[model samples]
Target: MGEGNWARVKIILRSPASRLKGVCADARFSGPVGRPAVAPVLCINGPEDKLFRSQSADITLSSEKERIKKMLSEGSICEMNLEVELFALQDSNAKLVAALHEANANVEQWKKQLSAYQEETDRLRDQVADLETHGGHGPSDLLKDELTQSLEELESLLKAKDEEIHILQSKKSEYHELERDRGEAIHRLQELEMRNMDLERRVQNAEQTLASSLEERDRAENEVHRVIDILDVKIFDLNDLRQSLAKLIDK
Candidate 1:
């Protein structure tokens, strides 16, 4: 038996033994109601009464023992199951945390790429303005080609950003599922709930920052397109001027 069980059994045994001793003491102290008692001596009940009471106490004690054993067994099983579940939850939480970290890292990397793209777009815009002020001379075609390439690259980056957003959305869904599973054990594990809430808050913050970054990228892409359109118009006008000059020289 376990220490706890042994302690309980000792209490059970003590109760009956103490009660029996008390009965003997009471019988010895009080004889017939008015008669004076002699020296304190052992008080004995009838053999049949003693036997019957002993048998009854034994039966009660045996039943209690069995009940306690059964409860202990059931409790052990429950504890084992809870341990298994706790292990599983810990493993899953670790994986989720690792994935969340990876996602955050990816977002940070994309943010850096977007910043670089924004800088490139600003430089291209300055180049286009310079070309316009100079009447679109000197390697106009090469600059136009470069601008087209940058535009394509920006569009591809935008597509990649959209894909990253989709991935984040999926991760969010997984988090929701994890939250629901954790909810089942929430009452039993307040500490896990607190940690989960903190993780959720972090994910929300990441999502907001990613959203803002996406907006900025969109604005930069629009500005680039506008600059490209202006360059195209300027190039067409320069082309017409070249054709008109060539016709005058031929005449």
Candidate 2:
């Protein structure tokens, strides 16, 4: 058996043995209050309880053997899968080796082609220099005229580019000035808003002060009316006393 199968078999065997030991221990420690108190049986043939325990142990062993057989079969399957993977890896490695050989052959062919191209380029350059040294005067004059015309066109294009750059610079300056004016306007607007808030607060405070003064004036007017009413009552009582004295004198 493989190592994994052997380990599983050992675990299965140990678990049942431990369980049987626990069962025996529980029976030995059982109390007489819960279990019936009976004398031990001594038979000439065999003990009946021992027979029952032996049958249970046989059943447990058979189950464990079946589990071991199943684990061995699984392990064999895993080995076969590992073998298939190893063969696939070997085939891939062989293909990679062949590709590397093909690439090396391609590199050799490219080197040969590059060498041939370099030889042709050198031969053409030599032919061009020889023609320039010994060729006729008429073709050279034509080439010089073409070169002068090309230089004049290039100079005119450069002047136009410089003028365009200057115009763009002036426009950029105007844009910066506009940006500065916008920032100033925003700052001024913020200042005006703050001033408006301060003015509003002062107006509210003045209104409150005016309302308090009006309340104090109304209270003073009411007190003055009360004093005038008391004075009029005292004057009427004096006039009645004077009239009674005059009548007594006449009688």
Candidate 3:
């Protein structure tokens, strides 16, 4: 089918033609008694002559048969080898396809997890914003104002002396309690901030993993295409070889 293959067929075809030409030339000049024979039938003069010619013809036919057998045997071996190689390539292609499917499944799973993480991150961000807005002027600010007013009252009460000492002590206890609550609220806010940072880091890692899996899938697909193309060319070559052998046999 290809120009190169056709050329090879032509070369193979010439061998048999050349062999036939040699046989013809031998019949014309190398006849019995060293005399040139115009035709094979004219060369025979007796039963012995006929016997010699028959024997020579039989030898030539036998040799040609053997040569043809040898060529066919070699071609069969080559075909077998090609078949084995084709089977191996097909197996490898199947494995690659399986791996590609597994990679696709993994990619899909990662996508789902990434989506979930993103939704959770968004929710956490919204909560952080709400806490910042409400808590900025909520319990902590109110407690600071109350503590400041209590300190002013205590300073003024200190000048009034012994009667109000007990009252001053009670206000001090309430101020310590409010300070502790503010510390706890700040601690909770810091923990939330830390949790948000960890989630962001996890989201970034998931994205990178997804990207890597996609690239690997692409590479696997390319390899499968390359193997398929190779198999096509090999099949073509095998067909061409079969056609050439058929023509040789016909000749």
Please give, for residues 127-230, the per-residue lDDT of candidate 2 as tens digits: 55666778842335555565456555556655765675576566556556555554555555555555556555554554555455445445544554555455
Question: Model 2 scores what on Cα lDDT?
Answer: 0.51
TM-score of each: 0.49, 0.41, 0.37
What stretches of model 2 exceed 4 Å from their correct place?
1-135, 138-149, 245-251
Relative to the true structure, how large is the alpha-carbon lDDT of every model?
A: 0.62, 0.51, 0.53
lDDT tens per residue, model 1, 1-251? 46776665456436875445434434433432232224332222443344445455556555555655555555556556656776787678779878889989988999899899888988987898897888866547878898879889988998989998898889878877876776666545554445445555555555555455455545554555565555445444444443443354354
Report the lDDT tens digits of candidate 3 across residue range 1-251: 66777777667657876455434444444322232323133221343344454455556555555655555555555556555555555565556556556655755665575566556556655655676698784335644465456555555544544334454456456555545554554555455555556555555555555455455545554555565555445444444454446565565
User: How many residue pairs of model 1 clash at the backbone?
Assistant: 0
Give the candidates in order of TM-score, highest first: 1, 2, 3
Candidate with better TM-score, 1 vs 2: 1
Better of 2 and 3 by TM-score: 2
Q: Please give the RMSD to the true structure for each candidate, in Å.
A: 50.8, 50.4, 34.3
Q: What is the lDDT of residue 157 in candidate 1?
A: 97
Between candidates 1 and 3, name the one with more favorable TM-score.
1
Worst 10 residues of 1 by lDDT: 35-44
| Model 1 / residue 206 / CA error / Å | 58
